[model samples]
Target: MKTRFWLSHLRRVSPMIGLAMMVLAACAAPGREAPTTPPTPNPTLTVSGGGALQPSPVPPTAAFPAATPTLPPPPGGFGSPACENPYLPVRLGATWDYQLIHETTDTFTRSVIEVTADGFVDQDEFAAGAVRQGRWQCQDGNLIYLTPGPVAGSVFAGEMQTDVTLESNEGFYHPADLRPGQTWHQKTVFRGQSTLEGEIVVETRTEVNYACRAEDFETITVPAGTFDALRVTCEVHFTTSVAEGMTFEIEEQSTQWLARGVGMVKSVGQTEGAPPYTIELLSYRLP
Candidate 1:
C-alpha cells in the first residue's frame, strides 16, 4: 500500500519538479513514524547546511531547523520579470504536453495549460483526475511561487484523509535570463496532516532547499522539435520532522534543459535512494 501510494503521488509531475517531489513522498510517513535508515548514507551529501548524517536509530529529540542558502543570491536579484524569461514564456492559453519515462518501461503524460498572470495550471488527466494550479508572483523581474498547486495525491482512499499546506517559501523559481555559470538558491517549508475517520492522526513538516547553477547552452531535440537549450544543474536537500521528535534527511540531484520560447524541454533526476527518471517535452503551443 505504501509503494502504490507513493508512486501515485510521484506521478504528479510539476513544471519545476525535482527533489521536492521526493521529499513529498517521504512526507507520507505518519507524524510519529521513525526513520528506517541513516539520514546520510554513502556519497556524502555536499548540500549546504546538510551537515553530517547521524547514526541510525534517530532519537526522538532530534531537531534540525531547515537550512538556508549559505551564499548570497547571484547578482541581479536571483530573478527577473516573469514575462522576461525567454526560456519560460508565460502566455495565456499556452499549453505544453510532456512525457515522463521511468527507468523501467513505465511512462506517463501530463500537461500545463491556461497560463495565468501569476502562474500556469498543471493537469494529469489520469493520475490527478482534476486540474491543479499554483500561484506565482513577478516583482521587478523576480518570479516566486506563492503557493504550489494543490497536490491531488493527498486524496487518500478509505477513511484516511491528508492535507498538505505550504508554511513558507523563499527564493525564485528561475532567473529572468540564463547566464552561463549563474547560480541561485531557494528554500520552502510544507506542513502535512493526516486524519483517520475524521480524527487527526499524524502531522509532518518538510523543508526543502535547492542550490542550482546554469551550465551551458546546446541544441537539443525532443518529440516536440529541436531548439537551443540551456543546461541547468541543481542539488536539493530535504529535512522532514515529526512531532514525535523524529527527523529524516535526504538529498537529490537533477538537471534540466530549457529552450528559448519553449520552456523546459527535458529533465533528468534521481533521488538519494531511487532510480533515475526522465521527463521530455512531447508537444507545446504558444499564443
Candidate 2:
C-alpha cells in the first residue's frame, strides 16, 4: 500500500516539471526578437537678431526672386530745354560723335547740313569710310526719315554713280506722340542695280520693318554725363533679295535712350547668332 501511494505522487510532479521546461525553452529561443528603444526628438534652431529667440523660417530648396519693375517718369518730367521736340533737335550744323562697342572699336559721326520745311538733311560717316546721307523730318509731331535727294555739292552727289535709291521711307521715333507703353511701326525699302562687264547685271532689294515702343523713362549714365532719358525698344526684321535667286532674312532687337535735345545717347543692339553691340555718345555739339 505504501509503494502505490509513492507512485501516484511521482506521476503528479512529472507534469509540473514538463510545463516548467517548456517555459524555459521558449525564453531561451535563438530567433526571438529583442525590445526596441524609442527615438529621441530633435530640438528646433532659433536665430537671434538682438531680440527674443524665434524659430527661423525654412528657406526654399529651389526658387528665384522676382525681378523689380522700373518706374516710369512723370509727365513732362525730362526733355530738351530749348527745342519743341525734345527727343530730336533738328538744328543745322549740329554734330554728334559716338563710339561703337563691338568686336572692333569704331567711330560714327552724324552732322546736320540744311533745315527743310519738314526736317533737316544729315550726313552719317563711319570711321571705316562708309557714308550715308538722309533727311530727317517732323511729320505730325513724329520724327521720320525720307528718301534722300541729291545735294548739289555733298557726298550724296557721289552716290548717283552707284544707281542706288531709297524706294521707301520710314520713321524711327515719335516721342511727341508716344506716351509710356505706346508703340509705333515703321517700314523702309532700298533698291540698287549694278552692271558688271557692261553685260552682267545684278539687282538687289532690301526691306526693313521696325516696331518701336516707348518703354519707359529712366536715368541713364554713359561716357557723357547722366541724363533723364526716354527709353525706346525696337524689334527689327530685315529681308534681302538678289536677282541671282538668293534671299535671306535677319532679325535684331535694339534699345535706345534719347535724352532731351541730345538725340540718341545710348543704343544697344542684339542679333541672332551674333554678339551684342552698343553705341554710346562720347560728345555732341548742338546749335
Candidate 3:
C-alpha cells in the first residue's frame, strides 16, 4: 500500500520485532517514490519565473499563489535573540513542502530523499524530459538505490539536491563541509521552467555527527515539534594526492558550520587506524 506508506517505515527492521537491521532509516530521494514516469512538458529542473521550461501544456492559466500562513513565533527562540526561521522569506515563488537527504557510503545504498518545491523567479530553466505542467517542482517520489539516470545509465543520474542557481534558487546560506563535529553540509540544486532536455540532481547532506557533536544547539525532533538548529556556511576548494615524499600531505578539506538539527554525513575519523568514512544519516527534515 504505497510501499507500506514509508516515512522510512520508522526505519525498518520489524520482523515482528525479531530484530535484524542494525541501522537503516535512510529514506530520502523524495522518500523513494520513483517509477510511474509520464508527465513531460517544462521540467528541466523547475522554476517558473522567466528563464524558460514551464512552456507547453502548462497553461491552465498557471495559478499558484496562496501559501502565506506562518505564525509560530512567540517562543523566545523565533524572531530575535539569535533565532528566527519560520521558513522565512522563502515565499518568493510559491511551491512548498521540500525535502531532501543524501547519505553517501558510495553506490546509492539509500539516502536520496525528495518532496519538491518551486517558483522564486529571476530565472528558471530545466530542459529535461517527462514530467511537466506548471511544474515548479512535482517529483512524485524519487526514491533511491543510486543509478537513476546518467553515468552510463542514459543520462538521468539519480540524486537530487535542488537549488542550482541561475537566479533565485531555493533559500540561502552557502558554505558547507566538515564532518567530525561542528558539522555542516548543504547541497541544494534547482532549475526547471520546461520544453524538456534534462538535468536533475537532488542530494542533501547536513551533518552534525556523533552524540550530536557536543552541541551548539541542535534539536530537531519533529512530528511537528521541537526545532532548534544551526549550521549554514561553506567554502573549501581542494586537490589532494601527494604521496611522493610525504612529509605530511595528509589530505583534508575544512570550512564547516553545521550545527542545526544535523543529518546525512555519518563519518570522518581518519587517523588513528583510519577506517571511518561513515557518511550515513538516512532521514532529515525541518524545512
> Best candidate per TM-score, number?
1
Question: lDDT tens digits, residues 1-287, model 1?
Answer: 00001223334332223223333345445563433332221221122253321112321121222442232222221122334556666655556776666543333334544444434433444333323344454533444543322221122233343455555556665765566667776666665555545555455566777778878788889988897788989887777776455576767788899886677899888766556768788887665
| Candidate 1 error regions (>4 Å) | 1-83, 103-121, 124-133, 146-161
Predicted structure 2: lDDT: 0.51
Candidates in order, TM-scores: namely 0.64, 0.61, 0.17
What's model 3's lDDT at 88?
25
Compose the digit string of candidate 3's lDDT tens values, residues 1-287: 00111111121111111011110112113555322232232222343574332212321111122442232332222112111222222222322121212121232222112222422111111112212111122111111111011111011222222221221112122111212223322222222111112332111111111111212334544322344543322232111111121111112222112233232223232211123232223333332
lDDT of 2 by residue, 229-278 (tens): 88988877666665444565667788989886677899887664455778
* Candidate 3 to truth, TM: 0.17
Span of 10 residues, lowest total lDDT, candidate 1: 53-62
Candidates 1 and 2 compared: the better one by TM-score is 1
Report clashes for each candidate as comma-separated counts: 2, 1, 60
Given candidate 3, what's the lDDT at residue 68? Answer: 26
Go through the candidates in order and give each one's C-alpha lDDT: 0.52, 0.51, 0.21
Q: Quick one: ranking by TM-score, best first?
A: 1, 2, 3
